[model samples]
Target: MPDNATRVLILGHGAMGRAFETLLSARHDVAVWDRDLVTGVETQPLEAAARGREVVMFALPSNPHDELAARLAPCLATNALCVSIAKGLDARGRTPAQVFAQHFGPRRDWAFLYGPMLARELQAGRPGFAMAASLRPSAGARLQALFAGTALHLDCLDDVHGAAWAAILKNVYVPLIGAADGLALGDNLRGFLVAEATRELAGIVEAMGGRADTAYTLAGLGDLVTTATSASSHHRRLGADLATGDATQLAASGANIRSEGVHTVAMVRAHALFAWERFALFALVCDFLDDPARLQAGLDAYLARRFAAPTGR
Candidate 1:
């Protein structure tokens, strides 16, 4: 327990961690750690780092998140509030809140942040926004205050599972969007892709016990645009690079912080169109990345599925 400092321990310093540090370091004490480093930051062991922190944000990629979080569980101070900035599918098959509760026990607090805010832009104080939920939703206020009227629009959301599910599902269509662009598709095609994907996800989440509003909020539309269309997105880049037959480069892009969606494509739990969304995306991504010869047909068929009458929509 250090004196005269509000310790903020940030795990996963890639984009979001640095965004927090770059923005909040001037007013708060911060330390960062990541399992693998794309760029270096002064970091401490998770247990050691958690020893006396007032706040701990888990900004990890979704892969192996459960294992890593379990390892981090005992290290946190009993009162430290945990926040997660992860917005991809869980390779570990656990919810972000579940991971936190397992680690810190019921006495501690936790939160999840999902939105369109890209780590790179957020770090530089660019315009950004996010939806958040916490056991102590007010705990989000501290962070919201830190971002205040800045480009980062911070709002409180009460639905945890729905928000998380929407966040994970949005990753599915971003690659499809990339596939669309790779094959010389227009905005009309991209828009059609997003609309169809949203309807499918909205229905699935509602059936799975989530709210329809989940699909229209910051986590859904916001994240889809950034990830699906942004040139800087690793997932979007993966699709385009693979389309160009640059498997080596595409593979290299994910080496540091691998996109969890790419890996989780094999295990998506939701159904999309006539088949499982996960399965359809997995096949398309594999072809776009592994066998470019089939990119055109895959992209076209996937798009057609979306805009094709919509089953009487």
Candidate 2:
């Protein structure tokens, strides 16, 4: 390690964790620990690994964030920054920021990294982009230092809540693109959905106490395009499966498929997070998930409503 290397601990050794390790290990002293250990790698206990670390990254899904945050809170260094890349909501409909704030409070330094960061591309040493938002003003600079000399690039922003919601909401919209492609609706519809999704996303983010423009940032529009079109994206594949009437795959347990959007749909609806009537596109997605048989008609009706003329004129 370089003389100026920072100590970093990455929680969760999944693909994203390993990708981050690959990105940062060359310049930083890095340690990784997962709940389940791989066969041939040496690892340390979570608490031990966290001590003295300047940055601790949670690369796991949002569902496990609560437990992990609670466990690692006491072990983290006083000024250490906690970064979460989770792009979904927890069972309680809380974003990663909500979970972190619950455990770390305002005093602790924490940040959210969100964007079009595909693990496969990052692992392959291809360039990736993300936005870093944190309560601490310097958190972005700290993250930039941590990943210096790597292909991953970071843009700093102050709208942490907006960025987080943008990231989460993008995943929810990706399925619509996949479903359109799966139905052979062509590129015209795909383009339309992308435009409408971005608009609706801005409104929803604003309503959720985030800046509307943040929806156009890397965390929202950038990530949405990547996840929507990527062949390897789980949510995209879920939409395709839904289009093909693959009930077996659609009904598979979350453990088997790991589609965050599916769980997001449930959480949003259950919590009544937004005014559903205002977001017709999102509401249509929720309706599709509830009854896949209505997809074709739903799309037709949605398009009709969009193209409908001014009433009574």
Candidate 3:
């Protein structure tokens, strides 16, 4: 190994994992472990892959973080930097960082990667950007050093909570954009939805102890634009499916595809984490998700709640 090479163990074999492998393997030693070996990356057991690796990157779904953390906790070497790229809430409404924090003790340091990174674009060596955030000073530096020459440029930021919440909140709002797109509401409506969603995201982030302005950063606005407008976005498709009442669309899309926004919608509703009533647009999306037939009513309610409250709640 070169003096600067970092041993990286990728915990999932999904598209994102392959993207990382393609980018990082150019300069670092990479190994991958996934239950399914569809990707051609070298496979190893959890313990074997994780042990002694300087960095363990998790590219799996949020729901699996708990189990992966359990399996990795025992094997990770001291001072291993744990990185999470998941932008969804786990089953318990904990974010990806929260999941790893549970299992990894002082032996593990933590960081998060977030932004408008599309796996296909990244794997193709197209220019991409992301934020690497950590409270620990060295964690971000290590990531920056590892990806020095890659097409992907990583900026180190200290606002881990803000970046994370923004990323997760964007998933919840993109489906609304998709639903509007499916309904053919025109550019005017799309523009309105984007603005409203961004405002609501900032408000919610602030309510949850994160800086409100962070919503305008790459993790928030940049990611929202990518996911909301992309042709291949599953959350947008789900919104369209809901708007058009087309059940078969999602069925045809495949069962393995999990829409993180679906769970996010449920979580925000059940937990009332941010005084959801203040977020008229979010409330409308949740109502629409619950019953597609209420689409018109949801819109009417959103308009009334938004305009009628100029007095400021």
TM-scores, all candidates, are 0.80, 0.95, 0.90
* lDDT of candidate model 1 versus the reference: 0.68
lDDT of 1 by residue, 128-150 (tens): 77887665766677667645545
Compared with the true structure, what per-residue lDDT tens digits does model 2 show for residues 122-153? 99989999999887778899998888789899
lDDT of 3 at 222: 82
After TM-score superposition, the amount by which residue 10's alpha carbon in candidate 2 deviates from its true location, in angstroms, is 0.6
Ranked by TM-score from best down, the candidates are 2, 3, 1
Top-lDDT candidate index: 2
TM-score of 1: 0.80
After the best TM-score superposition of candidate 1, give how far the Cα of residue 23 lies from its true spot, in angstroms. Answer: 0.7
Residue 223, candidate 3: alpha-carbon lDDT? 87
Candidate 2 local distance difference test against the native: 0.87
Clashes of each: 5, 0, 0
